[model samples]
Target: MDLNLRKAILSNISENDHKQLEATIVDAIQDGEEKMLPGLGVLFELIWEQSDDQDKQEMIKSLEQGVQQANTGS
Candidate 1:
């Protein structure tokens, strides 16, 4: 069986407007379930594809800070 998670996730949300998309992301994060990670990764892939170099750098910096904070148990 072939499961195309990314395609499925993208198709499910393809018609979402800005506010709906924001709500979807917030809901997924707040749920904190392992199953939601793939959906989040798909969303992040969309963001990465659309981002400019500066935006990508900023995202990397923010992610680095988040990882550091998590490591410190803060």
Candidate 2:
């Protein structure tokens, strides 16, 4: 099977308002299902592509901190 998940997800949600987008992301995270990961990855890819270098650096730093915290269970 050949499916363009990112393209399909983007197409489906492109017209969603800000609140709807926020709700979708929050729900996906709160649900804690493995299946939602690819959607989150697609969203992250979109954000990474659009972000400036400084913003990207900040995001990386935040992610590193999150990883560190998770590992330390803090």
Q: What is the C-alpha lDDT of each candidate?
A: 0.96, 0.94
Candidate 2 clash pair list: none
Model 2: residues >4 Å from true position, as ranges?
A: none
* Counted clashes in each candidate structure: 0, 0
Off by over 4 Å in 1: none
Report the lDDT tens digits of candidate 2 across residue range 28-64: 9999999999989988998999999999999999999
Cα lDDT, model 1, residue 68: 100
Model 2 clashing-pair count: 0
Candidate 2 local lDDT, residue 51: 100
Q: Which clashing pairs does model 1 show?
A: none
